[model samples]
Target: MPAADWWRSAVIYQVYPRSFLDSNGDGVGDLPGITAKLDYIASLGVDIVWISPFFTSPMKDFGYDVADYCDVDPLFGTLADFDALVARAHALGLKIMIDQVLSHSADNHPWFVESRASRDNPKSDWYVWAAQQADGTPPNNWLSVFGGSAWQWDARRGQYYLHNFLTSQPDLNFHQPAVQQAHLDNLRFWLERGVDGFRLDACNFHFHDRELRNNPPAALRDSTMVSSVNPYGMQAHIHDKTQPENVAFLRRIRVLLDEYQAIAIGEIGADDSLAVMGEYTTGGDKLHMAYSFNLLTSEFSAAHIRTQVEQFEARVADGWASWSVGNHDSVRVMTRWGGATPSPELAKVVLAMQLALKGTPCLYQGDELALTEADLPFEALQDPYGITFWPEFKGRDGCRTPMPWQGASAHAGFSSATPWLPVPPEHAARAVDQQAAADSPLSFARNILAWRRGVAQLGQGDIVFFDAPEPVLAFRRDLAGAPSLLAAFNLGGAALQFDWPQAAGATPLDGHGLPGAAEGAGVSLPAYGGWFALV
Candidate 1:
């Protein structure tokens, strides 16, 4: 009955294993590479490290299409390598969390291979399979997120199988108790191996309506936000995912975590994100916390930020939220909100805002130094998702380029061999070694993160908003036991001096990483300038 201590004010750093660092000469990151970089990660003041999928995989959807849940991929290393990495991370006081794709698996997986053999196979019901329509089309009108039919015809089974993303990745039949138990066993494998918890990939998509009912079309007026951005938001998606029965499955996983005092953080990537985030984290028996893409997009105004936080607070009393402006998915924050040309100072403002919000903050790799989305040419593209969309969409390869380790070293010292994705020209200039030598962009990030940990107001406090104009965001962090803090930021590229309410008895607080002339009130932002202080 105690408060959730795992993530209350913790900072989580995400490591996309393939791009973090390369130890061997294969041009890909391995467990040893990650182990070597733990100090760099821990030095950023992050309390947890959530690594993306590195389990046995075919690497079709990168690592999202998992082949085996319990085994480590050779590309990454062996079980002993992983165990060593976990120990090294814990030595740095970092809790390790691995991504578990329980929703589906690669067709090459033995379970999937057996399930697709024939109708009479013992594993036939393990995946979502159904007879084709009279017209020889898919069973339902459900569209895949990757843009097309959700069903693939399996000639051997003589029945179409469901795939919400790629055709090779079939949807797991959560209705089967054995499937649920198998996923739980996979969780146990990691828990016993010293992993702290899991970052459940597409958590709400684990269940579906058994009747194969069509989702009700979202009300045109109600669906405006989603309809404008992507095609996946066109439908209500009620039946295809976020089923009411998902609660029972969540409880099953939560119960397992409870046994070992572990925690689970679910990624609620739903069309109605706020509502889905509420449901997934509502009760104590459900997920410990959940995150969505509400702020990961290009929305940057004060109104948009306020509406997102306020709406979630109104929905549930016991739920916890995780906020992130930049992540592995979507465009980088610098490019997404600040456009192709971003205000360097504005990046600090956004970080300040995230630190002030009432939730755990996830920092994507290279975000602290305010790394922008690297431009990659068509020939060098590696991500199929981005390649298929072509000129319309350039894929995630830009944001996923290799992490630059040194400013002048070949390939930024990530590997002696070529990397899976080429390092960007601009990224090499912001390398870790360069940042370590002097006051560089990467060092700025480390200082900010380290200073945030020392500030009580930023760690735990009630957020109070002040009346401000369009791009100016003003708020106060008030705590009864801790000193009150006043914070302000300029969202625009211009500078304008303005007077704040004088009744707050606020005094100047030292500005750590921001410029000297930008901290005080009657001050204006020089493009992304932000300041926080104890009053």
Candidate 2:
């Protein structure tokens, strides 16, 4: 692969900084913790390590609400710690990608502080501020993704400021040229720090309609269709996000990335995410790759996966996609897709399916261990979203628990001090040390990733779905002048048999570590099983 195209078929591992490891015994993971584990990350055969935000913050929304865009938080470490991390990761042949939360900043951010100070301030226009209606209501029908109205009354400015997420995270006014320039300058600061790329958080929320038109009511309220916990999805979201000006801003971001030979993958959350993803990346002057919430939902059927991938392929002809099944914000794939009790067989199948697809794959930390979502009592829950919703929604704390590195050690070797979130007892037995055994899922995951790297057809090939019965997801991956590979999986809980005519001349590829049996006539997959063949 060309240097500029390294991300095209890359397998990127997402390291949620706070849960990865703790080096300072502060009960929270930090930059030095990540640096200490660089070799382990590289051993997974991933090309990039996408570290979640560690910037200075009030921790209201963790590091997403950045108080200082250009500095590392003292909680994580200082600037020197970050530089050491970059140096160590590069030494191990791993590219470092940091999260850039450009959509909003912590209310304590100097820009937000000054902008909210007074209407006449020079930075007053840097944030999205609007006046209330005669009735004292918000200017429009915009709703926050967290809960309630998106507008918050700022007494200092005597106006309502927009916050797409938490009220403490005030939205930036990208409509203002100065705001856009300042954000670009922030990116330039990181580029000068030798970062390889950026994971653009909430990339679509950069611009809202200047008119602040009322969003029309949504026609449906399906959880699978939109976020289930919050009513933010109850509106059409037409005016509040996915604005046309976002494309031009992405072009500006792309130009800056090009100057440093870096790459960017955008996180797009929208009502029509596929369409927005196509628009954001189709021109190549926008995001290098973009991923939506299509695969992060509760749906686990083969048909759903096929539709998401096919729709993206159709809509974004020239665009690219980066696929993920689990992240910091969602429940673990094992508990969501698999049963309450995590199954190693099911985990293997899911990993195979994600890697076999025709896009860049992202592996969340602890996913290789087949870790299930930690079951925490209400008092143990620290996520504000869950605390607010309580029983109806558990929030993201289940997925953000500390990683288990040693099964027998206290706190699972995550920290000497008490961990911010207790490590689940179920995950302790599946720690890195235990999973290093030959037959463990962690070993299987490493083998699968290494095998994927060797097969150019699997990594960079075009994907074509086969006409298989329900519960059976069969696809053929083909590249010009390379041997095509046939990959199939049983996503359901029952045994399945399928006659794949296209695999007539194919031979089973060993060392894939997937369960099931393959024969000359056809292949039989057990519950949550997979089969791969080189044709």
State the C-alpha lDDT per candidate. 0.81, 0.90
The TM-score measured for candidate 1 stands at 0.94
**Lowest lDDT block of 10, candidate 2:** 221-230
Mark the 10 consecutive residues where model 1 has the least summed lDDT: 221-230
lDDT of 1 by residue, 389-433 (tens): 777778788888888988799898889998999988787887777
Off by over 4 Å in 2: 222-226
- Please give each candidate's TM-score: 0.94, 0.98
Tens digit of per-residue lDDT, candidate 2, span 160-224: 99999899999999988999999999999999999999999999999999999999988875364
Evaluate residue 387 in candidate 1 and report its C-alpha lDDT on the 0 to 100 scale. Answer: 71
Question: Residue 469 deviation, candidate 2, in Å?
Answer: 1.9
Give the top-scoring candidate (lDDT). Answer: 2
